[model samples]
Target: MLAQVRSIGSRNACLAAGELPGGPWAARGGRTYRTGASGSTSEAITRARAIRSVTSVRGYQEVGRADLFIQVIPFASPEDARGGLTELRGLPRTMPQSKGLSDVGELRTVAPPTIAGTTHVEAAEQAFLLDGEHSRTLTVWCVAGQTVVVAALGGRSEAIRWPQLAEIVEAQVAALG
Candidate 1:
């Protein structure tokens, strides 16, 4: 199933190659970036392979620290795929911390794009301040058939290309079929 994910080009790309029907992911070149159940949560990625079964891939271009990233995964069925997309939609929330520390990040769902083949989609826009460098994260999850694709990008450049995140996910879905 991984073989059916996006493979932009086998040359000059960091490939997260694998075999199996996994969770949420991003595809670039031949690389497959596994996400939090396809979710973009520390709790999810830090857990296990089954928890992190989906995918991941870095930027296809320079956009924060390379800004954009995404994942694409195919499950055994649409139900499984919906599960993946739902997980990804579970954005980060305020976690209790020591009195001295605080979380400056904000996560919320924006409007879902009208992509042609998607069965469901959730778009999250996140923003935060850390060390004075303002960064924004745009994460989008789209479930089409038995596949789910996610695209997330942050940093100063992300706002300019934010609209492309939907385009990117739509491309991934189109590729899977």
Candidate 2:
């Protein structure tokens, strides 16, 4: 899986160095998510053989030095990929506990920009109180072909906005095509 995704390289990179004003996004190593002593694949996915593999690429944005992780999960078939989308949405919400700065904010649904071959798109965001600071994560996921592409941005006091993430997600899907 590492070789497969590593082969993607910069041509599929979410953000280029110096593409934005605050210099370039630094490359971070990526890892594959698997189930077992070695890795994990959820029972549901295993049952349907829906997922082939899960992998992600990360970048640290210069301005806030925030982390941007784009996870790509491809399935055996587009139908299974669609089911995987619903499964992702169903994962238990383990919201972080607040330490009195402010409670976690409500999730707001976001409308993803149109992409060709996308059968589904689901996006939402919620803010968390981190060390008395406000931090939010915006996730935009889409289903194209037999793959599900997800972009998760978080950990910085300054939030990573939608346009930036969307650009990355679009590039990723395009590269897969």
Candidate 3:
């Protein structure tokens, strides 16, 4: 999935991953990376094999003491994108363990506001308490058309509100266009 998004060409992919100017957050340490089409790393290869025509971009930022990781993946077609979206939507239900975190929470469906002129869009949001204190929120959006734009935002739960998540998704869709 990630590998596919990475191959979508650097500039647009980076924008889609939330490397926006004067946004709520800035890239952590101004550090960012982009992978080429021929990814050699084991993780890259695994992600590449999982999704068809996958390309991805990623950006990282710090919000207070919390870290935000943003990722965007674009697929070759809507059907392929829908398949990836379904797989993502099922992750919370299929996984019993939250890596090492004990306070796992349910994944809830979010009614994504219509992004006018976007081909198709779907979204989901989830929040979980880490170590029984700090909260983490994971919000994902998938837009389908000639390419499927899969965007995700992860940060300290309380630090990011639903409105902000929606804004991020809207920005990504606009960028994808």
Task: Give the candidate number with the greatest lDDT.
Answer: 2
Model 1's number of clashes is 16
Give one digit per residue, the lDDT tens place, for model 3 in 68-155: 4444545444665565556545544432255556565666767775654356667666666655655655555555454445445555
CA lDDT, every prediction? 0.53, 0.61, 0.51
Ordered by lDDT, highest first, the candidates read 2, 1, 3
lDDT tens per residue, model 2, 99-173: 554667777777766655577888888787777777787887788876777777666547467766667677667
TM-score for every candidate vs. truth? 0.58, 0.67, 0.59
The ten-residue window of minimal lDDT in model 3 covers 29-38
Show where candidate 3 strays beyond 4 Å. Answer: 1-7, 10-12, 16-24, 28-54, 91-102, 131-134
Alpha-carbon lDDT of model 2: 0.61
Give Cα distance to truth, residue 129, candidate 1, Å: 3.6
Model 1, residue 150: distance off in Å is 1.1
Cα error, candidate 1, residue 85 (Å):
1.5
| lDDT digits (tens) for residues 1-177 of candidate 1 | 433332322222222322111222333353544434344444324432343344544444342243455555555457777875676566444423324333456677788777768988887776664445555667778878766677665554334355556655665566566
